[model samples]
Target: MGKVSTFSPAQQAENTSSKIVVALERLSEAFRVLLWQEATQYGLSPIQIQVLTFLLHYPEEKRTVTSLALYFNMTKATISDAVKSLEQKNYLVRKPSETDTRSHSLHLLKEGRAIAKKVEHFAAPLQDAVATSPLKEQGVLLDQLMQLIYQLNQEEVITHQPMCFNCQHYTEKKGNYCTLLKISLKQANLRVDCPSFETRED
Candidate 1:
């Protein structure tokens, strides 16, 4: 008789989760490309659109590069590059941070604000369409997604610790990187065995 092939319950769960991630990633990328193309009609890149959108809802109307980097989980250099480009295009302005001289606060200029407002206005119908859904359903979906994200993060911590520890870009700063990321490093170490972990260039 041929040997029976069977996967443990854990193995089946892992396989299902992996497939879901791939599907979600592809869907996200497709939407992102579509959104970027839409932004081009207003002469804005996806990043610029995000920045402007953030600014519209930001209580302070501005943020430091460090703050933005942390919010976006990005590197300082990348944020600086984006800020410089926006400044040159008159879409953003940089001012000295009162709290930290070394760090500068970024503010959208009048032109930038105007453009952002336009984008927001243009997106109203789409936003309204999404908002029309029942709040309970939206909340349920949000909770489910949050739980899945937490599970994935826990798995990553278990599977990717050693790889993260050896990465040159890993910093030990508090509330910033490394240390915070290390809180779940054990699971991450178990998640992936890849040795190379470089910060995103963007």
Candidate 2:
């Protein structure tokens, strides 16, 4: 004889959802460890490496300490310390903003760029695993992940950074448009950390 277990459909669905949440959490922690391991090789902290990589991808306008603090959900003092350490290592340069003389913008130096390039490949394993899926499946997964990120931001559980879909300047019709810049945006051009991003009020 075999023991039988019974549960309602809703309870079964809840159990499955709980497992999914746990799996996502474990995956997130694994990626963090991978980043930390790569950072150590460059003699940098994880936050410094993150800032360098961010500056490499984003424009100078978004390289301010305040922006980094917001993106990382870190305090200004913590970001300032990381920026100062990077400056002392000659991996980054601080320049006074032309638009705002009181504020400084971060620029990655040659060494910083090199480090960013190296760290960028730290997620190769994850990428390769995702690549094994069909292209359409990959796209579906990305959309699902982005939706979760957007929801978390909306809930204020995470710091709200710039995303094209939620920006006041963004519009969708025949194609994506940036009303501020008056430019047509391609799907690939939708940025996660756009410099001109302004949150659209609901």
Candidate 3:
């Protein structure tokens, strides 16, 4: 072979990791397709829909334009444009941040919350497929995915995921433990996106 490439069928035939990477890429495309379908129905761009959906559940700490930009791997200007559009549509409002006078945070309006709730299920097809798997398998998959996300964050391939693995509250003595809650965690109890996550210092 000339080289080992993910796109090479010959390599993928032998490399399990390459195949998994290809599968993940395909799943990402599915996400985009589902998002676009919902976006068009609501007369919103895909990014705008994502912003509203994220704001609906995440806390105020992660609701600023800079935070959104970093989370989505987009520029601040792009997030600002989307936020402005949402404001004009009365979907959300920008309030002065309690922590930062110069910076403001976003809050979804009544209409915005409604839209986010509706569009959040756009990937129900994907979830429904995974839901058919055995609960034990689901638990294993979740653990594996969480580990992958943690590694990706370590490599700076992704940014600020707010997950349990990198959380200050998390530790593994015999099993997963939450220092903040003083509770032992099962695989099912682990959070991939935890609202209460505080970044652990190295």
Per-model TM-score, in order, reads 0.59, 0.79, 0.92
**Predictions ranked by lDDT, top down?**
3, 2, 1
* Candidate number of the best lDDT: 3
Candidate 2 lDDT, tens digit per residue, 39-147? 8888889888888888889888789999899989999999999999999998899999888899999999998898788887777787788899987776667656766
Per-residue lDDT tens digits for candidate 3, residues 110-142, read: 999988898888889999999999888898889
The reply for model 1, stretches above 4 Å from the true place, is 1-15, 120-133, 151-202
lDDT of 2 at 6: 28
Local distance difference test scores for all models: 0.59, 0.81, 0.90
lDDT score, candidate 2, position 201: 80
Supply the global lDDT for candidate 3: 0.90
Give me the runs in candidate 3 sitting further than 4 Å from their true place.
none
Note the residue pairs that clash in candidate 3. none
Tens digit of per-residue lDDT, candidate 1, span 1-202: 6532233444446577656666677667766766677588887677667777666666452377665665555677877787787788898888887777776677889988888787765455445655887766655554455446545555663222223433444443632245434643322132222334543333
Off by over 4 Å in 2: 1-14, 169-198
| Candidate closest to the true structure, highest TM-score | 3
